[model samples]
Each structure stands twice: as structure tokens, then as C-alpha cells.
Target: MSQAPDPTIHTLSEFLLHAGTNFQFFDLGRGVHPLDTQLFLDLENGLRPCPRPRQQHAWFAIVFWSEGQKPNHYIWFVKFPIDERGLLVAAARNHFLQIIVDALGQSLGEEKHDTLPDNPYSFVPTQSQMALFSAVTKSCLSLPFNDGVKEVEHYVNAPAISDWRKLSVQSIADFAQTLRDETTCHTVAQNMALYHEDFTRILLESAEAVSLPTAFKQHCAQYCADTFSSSPALALAALRALSSEQADTISQTLLNTLLDSKHADIHVLSVIAGRHYGQLSGHRLIQFFERAAALDEDESMEGKLFAGFFSDLVQLPCLRAEVLGVLRSTERSEVLARAFGHLFSQTQKK
Candidate 1:
């Protein structure tokens, strides 16, 4: 006689596979983008660390659906803590899995559950984040674009007659995902500067989710260069639009120029640290904190701003070592050293 199959789900991916559902994973930590299935599996199995962690946690969203006479789709926005090495804590994962098993039980994929049960691991994304996630997931699944896509297309094609204010965040997000197409990218690049600053800002913000084509990246770099002196705000907005992973030489030079200038305010430094962090290393990384320290002296924040920003950056696995190196470096400026000392004192007090 054969023994019964062992009823065990070792991982979330295993659980989903066992339930006979189609699914996809999106990393919500750094920026909204598709997470590779294999990479996620490796993370779950302790094979590797999470590549993009935010606030010391690996935040991600899982979209899954069952196929049958009546199909049901569900999304789970969850976060799990990561240790110093950026590895996900297995205890949290096991706890969440236990919660799912208790709530859904044997009917995991068979029943249509309109709402997810209460759990500590779950979270609700912001409206803009939700909109972008929806647009991205739909595009990834090859589903039809929402109504907002048409409006965005028409406006980009003819900006003068269109009302930028009428365009919704959802529409901009949908259009951002379409930048992968050559024609769409060219049209947007040609007309990007013509749109109102507000419209351009939203478009660029949404564009952060997708890897921009060469034309779009060049246009954004040019926009930053042209407006940096005349309209710093617009230049900042354009900078926010750039993707850290796709920063070409021109973009890197532009960022270096911005940091080298006395006008690199706290906001500029913050944007660089937040969005274009991958570019921060070696001389560039040192220059970033130097700028931050200078701003602290001028702003009269008592080094709080610098300390807070440093604290946040040090939590990131990629930047932690570099940030510490900066602190230990004898080459750092006197102001930076003072700032580091103050940061140390603050930490000791706490």
C-alpha cells in the first residue's frame, strides 16, 4: 500500500503552485517593477538577499489568479523584515504562511474570496502607487489599456489644445508603461518639454517605474541641463524622472555637475539619495554627503537633516558599507567629519 502524500508547503511560491494559480511578483521596495520569479524563489529559499530593500524591509506584492469556470484574481501587498545582511527572516515568512493556511485552508484557490483576511504582514499602497501597480501589472499581462491611455495619447500627440489638469494619475502611469514602444517613446520625447510642468512632473514620476528608452533618457537629461539654471524646480522634476539602473554617461555627468554646484540644496541631495542612489559611490558618494553637510550648516537644522539622511542610507544593504567608509575616511571634509561625530553622539544618546 502506498502512503498518502505529505501535506506541506515549504514556501509561498510552493503554496501558490500547489493551489494551481497563475501568479506574478512585483517589488514595491525601491520602485514598482516586476520581480523575477526565480529571484523571488531564491529569496524565499535563503539562496540570496533581496536586491532592493526599502526601510530595512522587503516589500512586495503578489498577484495571483485561479483559472476555472469562474476565475478569481487576488493581490497581497506584504512586507517582511530583513536582517543586517538583507536576507529575509524566515520566521516572518513562516508566520505569514501559517496565517494564509488558517484563513484560506483547503479551499485556497477554489473559492472566490472578495477580501483578504486580517494579517499583520499585509499593507495598503498609496493611491498613486496603486494606480501605477495596476497599470504595470495590466501591461505585463498584455491586457488592454485603461480609458486613461487614450486621453494620455491624445494629449501627448497634441499638447496645446489639451488640458493637462484633466488627466488622471492613472492615465499618466498607463502612458509611462507604453514608453517601451519606439514610436510612443519618440513622440513623448519630442513633446515632453511642451507639456505643462505639472503634467511633465507626473509623467516623469510615473516613468520611474519603467526602464526608459535611449531617446527618452536623452530628452530627460537635456531637460535637466537646460532648466537647471533657469528653472531649478523643473530640472529637479526631470531628475526625479530618471531611472537609476539606466543612468548613462550623460546622466551621470549631469548628476555630478549638480552635486558639484553650490546650488545643490538639500532637496537635490535627497532626490539623488532616494532615486539615483545607484550612482552614488566613490567620489560621487563623498560629494553627496559633503553637499548634505554644507546644507546643514546653511539651514540651521543642527545637523539633524544630515544625521537623519545618513541613518536612512546606512540601512540600505548596497549603501551601508559605502556610507560607513565615508564616515571612516580621513579624506572626508572637516564639516563632514563634524557631522559624522554629531551623528555618532546622537546614536550613543539613543
Candidate 2:
């Protein structure tokens, strides 16, 4: 939206209509509550394709979007407007931003100010709507949020953005070391964490497959694993940076730690990965499951990798009927259900 001279009258109506839902002339002022999580989940989780509506209106929603930025679960403040083609336009439908802008009377473009501007929205944010927007802006500035923002930013315009492919293990090792550096700005740490998924992708898909130093691999994997052990919330970041864009050695290293081995936290990290990353890379991890299924039988204390992530992934037919038989023969329904919920929540997206 262009900068309007009148800024005091922030229209929540505009924000609602653009936030995703099927409605006609819906009033944001009526029959709704801000941060209606129950309403939010009802609209979001059961979504099929947007049925190109003649008209669309709903409140500024915090959607758990499964599209764009792979494995990224987004709380989109989207505007779901039907184009002439009967398509629900994404970018065109955002409503809350205008409200925020109008409410604050701030300019929509680049700021002349050097420091972060105090966000002007509501007196008290209803939920994560403001925080999500704040993160969107700060994604550029480098800030840490939850790891669910996992994605590979293949920026078309900025090709020169640090090509993780060209880096040696030494360079990545250097970057990881810098995560603890006192002088490294918060902006720098933010950028480093953001590149987690991109780096993982580089490791997975690289043609040349950068060769990493053993020392670097051990250092990164250990720190990330330690962090994962300490905080499952940080696992996505740790996995992304540790496995991404580095050598196969690095990817294998982390996978070995998480999948091949078993700790409660390691299992939790694996479950989260299968939740999000499974959306993109489930095919790759299937074999890891097969190996675990065979090895983890009897749930032995001596040695057994948990197949929670794997069992769910291989539920689809094709590779092995015997595998299905083997999967069913086991009676670990609770563990299996937990895995299913995690995997289902992530992949049940579609």
C-alpha cells in the first residue's frame, strides 16, 4: 500500500479481509476475538486449496502456512483476495500490515533511521501477529526466533549472498566459532542462524560437495548436538547450520548423531526434523528408517535407534510390505502416535 497522509484511522477491517478465510463483508468487530487460536486452527489445519472466491474477507489471521520457504511453518498475515482468475492472491491480500501502518502512520519503505523503530501496532499485541511481523523485518537484520522458520532462501535477486557451496569446512568452522564471538553483532548471529536450512540444503544437494575438515565437522556437530541436547527449540537451528551447505561429512555426521544414535533429546530433534524437514526430504531419510527398524527391534537398551520419525515416513506403500508387517507387529502405539502427531502435524499440512 502507498503511504497515505491520514494515519490515525487504522482499519482492522482491511487486515481481516486479507487474512485468510472465506467470508463476505465479514465484520472484524463482530463474532470474533483477536488471536482466536481455536478459530485460527479451524481455518488453517483443515485447509484445502483456496476455492477461488468471488469475494473474500476474514480477520488478520496467524496462519500456519505450509507453502513457500520449505518446511517453514508460517503465521501469515495474508490477504486472501480472489483475482479475476478466481485465484486467492497471496501478496495482494495482506490486510493487517496496512492496519499496522495506518495505526502507526509509519512509512512503508526503507527507513532513514539507523536504529530499530519501535513497532506501532496495538497497545497490547493479541498474539504472535506483531511478533511474526517483527521477525519478518528483522529476518534481514538477523534475529533469533523459533526454529520452525526453517527454509532455504534461494534469493533470486541476491545471487552474491554468501555462497555456502564455495566455503571450505574451515570457513564454516570459522563461522560457527564466531557464533560465540563477543564482537560479532547480534545482526551477524541472526544471519548465521537463518542460514541453517540453506546450509543443510547445500550439504544435501551440492554437486561438488565441499570437503570439510574433520576437526571442523566434530566441532560444529558437537556444539550443535550439545545445544540440541540442552534445548530442543534450538535443534532446527543447530541441524540447519551443522548439516547445511557443508560437506557430506557434515550431513552424515549430524545424522549419525541424531538418527544413528539415541538420546532423549536426540530423538526429540529427530522427531522435529521428521516433522518439518520430512516435508522436503522425507525420501532421503526413509533408508535411515529402514536401518533403524531393523536395528531398533525389541527397544534394547544396549543399542537401538528410535524409529519414531522413520516409522511414520515409511507408512506409504512401495518399498516394503514386509516392512509394513514388521511395523505393525510391534505394539508401540503410544510412541508411534506421538511420532504420527508430530509427523502428521508437519506433513498433515497438505
Best model number under TM-score: 1
lDDT tens digits by residue: candidate 1, 109-155: 44544355788889899987898888888888776677878888899
* Prediction-by-prediction clash tally: 0, 13
Which portions of model 1 miss their true places by more than 4 Å?
Answer: 1-7, 68-72, 110-114, 228-233
Top-lDDT structure, candidate number: 1
lDDT (tens digit, per residue) of candidate 2 on 1-350: 64563343333333333333222221121111233344333333333222211123233434232223342332333334433322334443334344444443443221321122333211232332243233332332243543322212222112247454554432232233223333332333334344545453332222111233444445545645776555554554445434332125555646655654444344544533432232223333443544444344445522224444344333322322443443444443444434434444655555
**Candidate 1 lDDT (Cα, whole model)?**
0.80
**Candidate models: Cα lDDT each:** 0.80, 0.36
RMSD vs true structure, all candidates: 3.8, 16.0
Candidate 2 Cα RMSD after full superposition onto the native fold (Å): 16.0
lDDT of 1 at 127: 85
For model 1, give the 10-residue run with minimal summed lDDT: 1-10
